[model samples]
Target: MGRKLMSTLAVLSLILQTISAMNVICYHGTWSRYRSGNGSLKISDIDASLCTHYIYAFVGLDSSTYEVVSLDSWLDISLNGFADAVALKESNSNLKVLLAIGGWNEGSAKYSTMASNSTNRATFISSVISMLQTYSFDGFDVDWEYPARRDSTNSEDKENFALLLKELREAFDTYGFILTAAVSATPSSADISYDVPSLSTYLDSINLMEYDYFGAWDDVTGHNAPLNGQSVYFGTTYAEYNLHSSVYGWIERGADPSKLALGIPLYGRTFTLSNSSSNGVGAAVSGAGPAGPYTASAGFLGIQRDFGRVR
Candidate 1:
């Protein structure tokens, strides 16, 4: 069964690689099931034709086994979520489904540990390939969430990360499968974590997570994802946090523009007005706004629900 699957995958991978450029990439978080309110947002709810690639957000790595693991059993196994996701290709033959691994708060420890050693890296590569084969996925999207940082990561992660990508790319090439990554937009974060030139060579695309510039964490409110850094907030310029700075920084540091995809947020970040009269772009914020009726986060859905309330 393994050999048969590999053979079938190799053929499909070739077909997918030969397709035209990807215009849009949509990330579908499986956890949206619990957050969507009514019941759960199924793979069937997606309009596959809207994007050239659809990334199913997160399949985790087992810290001990260095193998792929499901974060949600109901979504991954019970509902056969991945299979349904791949089924989207039935509607738009051009759509490619890639499984993402790692996310914010998912922790960087396992990934750092796996990348820091050759034996572990190889095991992880094999595991990822097997997981893709099992799920009938088109490719893999690595989302380590800022490697080489303190807490759950080591200083060696930057170099090891490049090596990991190199190894993964070689294996992916064998099957003609796509390879991509979701990277930090913060200039300092990007600088400390990536060897952009070497890494770019192996990635089909780098999804720049340009959102979350300012949120509940900040004492001052600002755009969640600004196209340009023209806005100044509370005497602390937000110029570095905008999309232009991120894209330009990566390109200046050796990433290719053609292979870069700027991420846009479907939701908005909300903040509690510190001074109601001072509400504007750089207003003071006490903390996060109330939760949404459905999404249950102080984001777009929440703000939408209270739009007419005039807080």
Candidate 2:
């Protein structure tokens, strides 16, 4: 997803490449069930061997109490979505399943409000701990969209976001719960929203959302994730928009390389070409491609291993 955020739904294919073994993290968008036919995915359909970790995308935050709550109690709680997802561990003993709180839909203003105050943060942490315990979640994920990037949030969010992670780290440690966060790929958002060094100190993994360089919203068609920047964007600030720059940008900002998880989108954002012959990168596009059959939505929809040449 872009910082503009097309949808709260993201099938994050995060590969945590460590020195010893490759750890794959997959996100199960629970709402997929609402999609018709094969678009629907339940925990039972997962191949646990393929993933080292599975994240349940989005349980929400309550405005009144600042506590985390399931967005779909009927599916997550009553239907045993939580239990079923965690049960993937049984299929692969090394697999750890966690639940994410906060998404594009959850918005930033409230999280800003919740994180800035010690009393609200405490209440939020307590509820997270309770939910983790009750649902048997191995860990928790924070996908707050952004901390200070929105107009609704203030500058204090940069510091308060780190504090929230610090507090969450302390609480999660009591049960050996792993902590992770999904963050924006572009520096436009990252620079404004994150204190990378401070938050990296608390988070076990920092998942870099490294896709969405271009989407249906664009006038030109481009790679969703290019290892190197497109020539069209060259000499522009957007020239840094690619996997190589995004990852190293974090590393340059003092994030531990080992804790960095490279995230790629498992979806595509298509465009209807104004001139099909010019359908390469930077080609002019009329508008969004076409509505997906299963997703039943208009839009939603990258590159090589050359590292140094990209910049």
Candidate 3:
């Protein structure tokens, strides 16, 4: 047993600056507070200069209330996560601090219910405005995992989601709060989840989550964010699985190219190898690689951030 079988790879990604200037949207995960030592990335550690917009991720959606709420009262309120994050504005006057709601954990069902009803959507919108005002944030970002995806046969979510954004945009406009959404990179998910034209019209920017091309879910080990597919041997899915497809996938689907902010994962995907001798790209994997000292998640290590076209 001279050599270890498991391999951990950071998902490398590039922020394409197609335009002369670009929007570097930074999403700060408040939960990093739980990680002890240097692994802990407190709001105060954020360098506002490197980012154009600093977004505080993951405020919760009250399943029963359909209103915006803080998931962690201690971190967000008592520890001043939101306020301390907003205070970064003093360092960079141009940095727009935004509050984000919904993520993978919140799931699609509740959001579907909230957006399905006009009254509920209005209530959610009102809560959003109040929260933004209370925190003195410059904008709001909706990160519902997806819309319309919850019920594919019915296009209700698709249609209603558009209406929701339209009203949010109208309300945000009056308050001058920048509005944005964290959109999926998978083309199929986009096909079901987004009403692209409305997304283009209403959003100040769309955070394109372009990483996670591969993970422990697959039998073979692969890059978490490959620039392009490795080879023909890996099949067409592999060819289309890269970043190129993801960026253009959204653009081709009708999202404004200028509004798409390319997201890059700040962490890596880890895989434990079944055979130590076969530790190569298509090698067999037993399970997720050992968790990072900081993240502590078995199959995944993480952080997400993005950049967009600056007009």
Can you give the lDDT of residue 33 in candidate 2?
67
Q: Against the true structure, what is each candidate's TM-score? A: 0.88, 0.90, 0.88
Best by TM-score: 2
User: Against the correct fold, how does model 3 do in TM-score?
Assistant: 0.88
**Model 1 Cα RMSD, 1 decimal:** 8.1
lDDT of each: 0.73, 0.76, 0.74
Report how far residue 54 has shifted in candidate 2, in Å.
1.0
Which parts of model 1 have CA positions greater than 4 angstroms off? 1-22, 36-39, 231-236, 299-311
| Model 2 lDDT tens row, 138-183 | 9998988778865445668988999999999998888899999988
List, in order, the clash count of every candidate structure: 0, 4, 0
Q: What lDDT score goes with residue 257 in model 1?
A: 77
Query: Residue 203 deviation, candidate 2, in Å?
Result: 0.5
Candidate 3 clashing pairs? none
User: Candidate 1's residue-wise lDDT over 1-311, tens digit each?
Assistant: 11011111011101111112647887776666654445245678778888799888778889998888898878788988888889999999998899988876566788898888899888899999998998889999998865876455578888889999999999999988889988887676778889999878999988877666777767777877677775444444656778788888988999877888877655556788899999898878898877555555553332333344434
- Looking at model 2, which ten-residue stretch has the lowest summed lDDT? 302-311
